[model samples]
Target: MDERLTIASAKANLEKGSLSAEALVGSCLETIKQGDKDVHAFLELSQTAIEEARAIDARRNAGEQLGPLAGIPVAMKDNMLVQGWESTAGALILEGHKGSYNATVTQRLKDAGAILIGRTNMDDAAMGSSTETSHWGPTKNPWDMTKVPGGSSGGSAAAVAAGFVPVSLGSDTGGSIRQPASLCGVVGLKPTYGRVSRYGLIALASSLDQIGPFAHTVEDAALMLQVIEGKDPRDATSVDLTQTTIPELIEKDVRGLKLGLPKEYFLEGMDPAVKKTVLEAVDRLVAAGAQIEEISLPHAEYALAAYYIIQPAEASSNLGRFDGLRYGYHSSGQNLKETYERTRGEGFGREVKRRIMLGSYTLSAGYYDAYYRKALKVRSLIKKDFDDALKIVDAIVTPTSPSVAWGLGEKFNDPLTMYLSDIYTITANLATIPAMSIPCGFVNDLPVGLQIMGKAFDEYTLFRIGATYQSLTDWYLRSPDTFST
Candidate 1:
């Protein structure tokens, strides 16, 4: 069994009868068993993974038609609801909680014949930038066990990087998916805000959160997105994509395409090695006949500030339902008020509580206009910045994260420094545009990602540029040494 098999290759092999779904799923399960003890990427393994694989194999043997992802094994972030399985969201509040319904993406993947492997760990309530805040434990980078694999989607990214699965699902609210993918040296895509349905996902910031795919290659990521992208009646934010089809990303020609390099992204404080590697990638695109132009996003500097205010405000509202009156951890108290306070106090983590407090304060009387409303205005300006830039350039390119993977505990004590980690990725989320992180080069032996951003619902352009870049480089082909053993 080839442990490095990608979705496309795996599908081809399965179709040719050269690979059985059982063998493929078994290889991934074995890999997880051998490596997960040290990596801690998975929070729970799916009991039905092998059974599902057997069902797919039986159908194939009977000559039934298969979907694009038929027999492919997939891991999902714990925040996504999968009926009959635990969906803890890495928080103590929902420990041992079982999902009663399937998330739209989960159901879509199941319909496409992909085998659901397990749920991976993440930041508690998907609030932190690193997985260190997970109640269970942090997921270590596959490249170096001492370092972090970025988050709040760290486990999803780490699983793909560790060769446990070809693809995994992750949510990005201010770079949760892209930043982790950059650190893990894999492909992560955060589709446009309304491109995919959000029903059944444990909300972080309803306005900013987006579910996407993490895979070893751009094609695999695209394939997963294709299977899951579309509107659902259950989610009002979902947009109808019946008239517009996702482009088939083939590495044909990239000539005449103009890509922007935002001046704000290249500012000081960025690691010198990361800058050099990304610039080298830009040069490679230039050599491939694409044009690189310097662009200005003046409001980009304010994106981080605006995102923090808006995201927390939305998060506070979304998380209000978990006050122990419903289904989550509950603490006993003398009265109703005390019960509410005690339940939240004990059930929530420090970071989650802090954000809730901040959010509550921002939305309070007299402060709404000064903070939340103003932040919404700033968000508009940030979106306008991308709109203006896209009018001239086909897409925007930048480093996925300012630096490569850092030591597990390096930024735990300093929240401000940790916030800066998503400086490059938050802008795209704020703008509600599609963006992707593809492995471009290495810095001190750690992988660096080149992020490609496109206009709303324009994932095809981002995928085209990413696929083209991957075709000219072997960075995505490399894997952690632990996998080879």
Candidate 2:
């Protein structure tokens, strides 16, 4: 069994009878069993995975038509609800909680004949930039166990990088998906805010959160997005989008495309190797007949500050429902207030508590206009920055992260430094535009990602650029030696 199989290749192999769904799922399960102990990417395994794969194989044997992802094994971030599966968002507060119903994406994948494999680990309550804050434990980078896999979608990215699954789903509130994918050396896409439904996802920052895919190749990521993108009645924020052929759209040539290199994105403190590697990727596109031009998003410098304020303010409001009286962990007290205090104090992790306080403080009566309102205004300006810059260029390119993967505990003591790791990615979320991270090259043996940001709902352009770059380089095809056969 080929452990490195992608969704597109797996589907073709399954159709040709050269690969059985059972064998494919079994290979992934076996790989998880053998390597997951060291990587800790998965929080829980789906016991029924093999059974589901066999059913798909049986249906195919009977000559029934299958969906695009038929028989393909995929892992979902723990935040996504999957009926009958534990959906803890890496918080002890929701420990042992099972989804009563499927998230829209989960149901959609099911309908597409994809086999749900398991749930991956994440930062507790999706508050941290590194997986170190996970209540269960941090998910180590597959490339180097000592290094941290970027979070809160670290586990999802690492799963694809380690070849445990061809694709996985992750929610990006503020670079949660793209930053980790950059660190893990895989492909991660955060679609336009309303492009996909968020009905079943455990809310982190509702306005900023967007669910997307992690895959080894741009085409695989596009394939997964194609299966999941669309409006759902359950989610009011979801847009009623006309589905396009993403796979075919991504195959278009990059010639005549105008790519932008935002001057503001090249920060002073960025690692020299990362900058060089990203520019090399741009050169490859230039060689393919694409044009590069320097552009400016002046407000980009303030994006991280604004995002920190807005995200937490929304997070505090959204997490109010996780009190002990609900379905999750409970801590009884002499009074109702004390009960709420004890339940949250004991159930929530340190980082979660800190953010809740920060958010609450910022949203307080006197501080609302001073902080939250100002941040919202800054967000608008940042969006305008992207809107203006994108009018002249097809897409904006930059480094996904300022640096490669860091040691597990390196940034744990300093929250400000940890937040800076997402400086490049948060602006896209703030702008509500589609962004992607594709492996471009390496820095000191660790992977570097070339980021592409596109206009709202213009994911096709980003994918086309990514696919073209991927065609000219084999960076996406490389896997960690620890997991490689």
Most accurate candidate by lDDT: 2
Scanning candidate 2 in windows of ten residues, the lowest lDDT window is 243-252
| 151-178: candidate 2 lDDT, tens digit per residue | 9999999999998999999999999999
**Candidate 1 per-residue lDDT over residues 1-485, each given as its tens digit:** 22466897788899999999999999899989999999999999999899999999999999999888899999999999999999999998998789999999999999999999999999999999889999998999998999999999999999999989999999999999999999999999999999889999999999999999999888888888888888899999999974343436355467999999998889888999999999999999999999989999999889989988998899999889887876778898999989989988998898998889989999999999999999999999999999999999999999999999999899998888999999999999999999999999888889999999998988888888888888888899888887754
TM-score for all models, in order of appearance: 0.98, 0.98
Candidate 1, poorest ten consecutive residues by summed lDDT:
242-251
lDDT of the candidates, in the order given = 0.92, 0.92
Tell me the number of clashing residue pairs for each predicted model: 0, 0
RMSD of each: 1.4, 1.3
TM-score of 2: 0.98
* lDDT of candidate model 1 versus the reference: 0.92
Deviation (Å) of 207 in candidate 1:
0.5
